[model samples]
Target: MTAHQLLGSDRHRDLRVRAERGAALGDAVMTSLVVPAEFRRVQDEYPILFRMNQERTDFVALALFGFENGENLFLKGDRWDARYRPLALAIQPFLIGHAAPDSDVRQVHVDTASPRISGDGEGIRVFDGDGRPTPYLEEVAELLGELDAGYRESAAFFAALRQHNLLEPFTLEIELDDGSINRLVGYHAIDEQKLAALGPDALGALHGEGHLMPIFMAVASLGRIAELVARKNQRNADG
Candidate 1:
């Protein structure tokens, strides 16, 4: 089934709720702890920051270090790689926290009943409902790993919000490379007046202090921030 079909009925309901509430949690943490840390580090390392794009799923912050090739890097939320599974799983609880308890939400379970290497002898494969080899098994494994690692942290944060009854309404959309999108999860409406009172600068400072290192490290591993920007600009111009 396609990703949308795979979402099933319950998943769709969860998506709707997340689209309305997830952003408050994401925005609060990111603006307060993630962005400022990144800004400080980038500023110290590079002479200038050319463009910084922060959306719910698409987060691209870049800096320009005037080396021979110039240096650039970006952090992204969506990836097909297995390495990100832990992160995805970590975020799942928060996504589902606002889900209706009686919703037909079912955990995905893989049957490792029989595993075999592919015909190409290059990788292992597993059979699904029909006896066909599921593609991207390796990628799935990596995602699982990321999910395992990330779940606890996400749960803790989500729990705190629930305890304080501060769960805010927000939305989250995952834009894939195939031009299709998925609404992952959400929460309740937040106190806008209080959030607004924090102001942008204060929020920025918080992000810089708390989340900069992890975000910076993730992007740097993906690509050179400077190069990515240059390539993006080139693509826009050509288009």
Candidate 2:
């Protein structure tokens, strides 16, 4: 059974994390979160696209890893081959949760089923013998703080995208080396035409809100698709 409990020095003091990377640790995915705060870092390593939520009320930026489902081409021998790891994938089994059902107080929780976590003393200790958090735990706290802030920033960033009509549904046509053509649908990206048509006042509003740079960054990120295609071809050839 999967359970998430509040971290405590007494209860989780002996816990350790093996810290594996890639699919073995559940990193296999076609897309994951891309925070506006990390847009510059993500654009160089992966293709950035936007996808509508299931409710269709909003969109979320995604860092595309592969052309197909369950295909993270960035994974190589259980190691991620990227300089900057997306915050959504960098931290696993750890999240900030409320202390109570209606409480506003945030606390850290972990997924007990995660393979990265252990009680066999094989990974970084959760706490020191004096019942204080270890450096690993401290780092986890910092990561959670950053991830939380990034997502909050995204809420406003995506809202701005929607308000400006800057997003459009997109489809990707992929032709693999093995003589198969595939199409990816149901995602969105910046509509350059609409963006260009915006009046100066509107553009100034976006710029003042700190959305201009990330917008151009996301647009420029389309170039990374060539790199992804090349990697896919290499993987196919190696098989």
Candidate 3:
């Protein structure tokens, strides 16, 4: 159902993408993959959590949006009720692709099946009449570049966390105002006790590796969990 194509000016000269926020545009998600580079902004709005991939080979960070699947409490009509959206979510319909598995070259790929792909000249144009990329396309390209670099940085960060044994399994339990219980499992969080127990050598190693700030940011992000619950309660009340 995904029709990905290498974005080219000549082939997609008239291509337009709707830059709107809504479930119809694939914005209704409970979590978005985040990287350490965006942790400062993400922690301010969303709780940063960690989860292992389906293969259980690597750990990926996530910005939590809701407690349930496909439930984005931040969705208020067509607007996302947050100042910062995780890059993984913000870079919709566009993804970084490689020329080959062994190639370092990156290319922009567009999902042609996305609802954001406009056919009636109802959205932002990718290329102008001169075949040059529009401002929006340029911005998207920059975002993709950042995302690509962030992914590489994230792999190193996760490896460091594993090396230090700083991640621990976590389960979140939420009780709504209406007395309904919700549980979030299969996730991990920074082990504060273990972090505090680290000696000067380990601390220095983490700081030297440029991961200390983001680790603290991820820890600080847990405070946003309460805010997330409040949003869910408000959503229920509205309904």
Candidate 2, residues 27-136: lDDT per residue as tens digits? 88888887888889899898899987779787888999998899988888778888988887767778788878898788999887887787677877878999998887
* RMSD each, Å: 15.3, 1.6, 0.8
lDDT of 2 at 158: 87
Scored by lDDT, the top model is 3
Weakest ten-residue segment in model 3 by summed lDDT: 84-93
By TM-score, the best candidate is 3
lDDT of each: 0.32, 0.85, 0.93
Looking at model 3, the pairs that clash are: none
Q: If the candidates were sorted by their lDDT against the true structure, best first, what order would they fall in? A: 3, 2, 1
Q: Which order, best to worst by TM-score?
A: 3, 2, 1
- TM-score of every candidate relative to the true structure: 0.26, 0.94, 0.98
Give the alpha carbon lDDT tens digit for every residue of 136-200 in model 1. Answer: 33345444444444443333433332343433443435333445443423322333455445657
Candidate 1 lDDT score at position 21: 20
Q: What are the per-model numbers of colliding residue pairs? A: 36, 0, 0
Position 100, candidate 3: lDDT: 91
* Deviation (Å) of 207 in candidate 3: 0.5
Give the Cα error of residue 84 in candidate 1, in Å: 9.5
> Pairing residues by index, what is the TM-score of model 2?
0.94
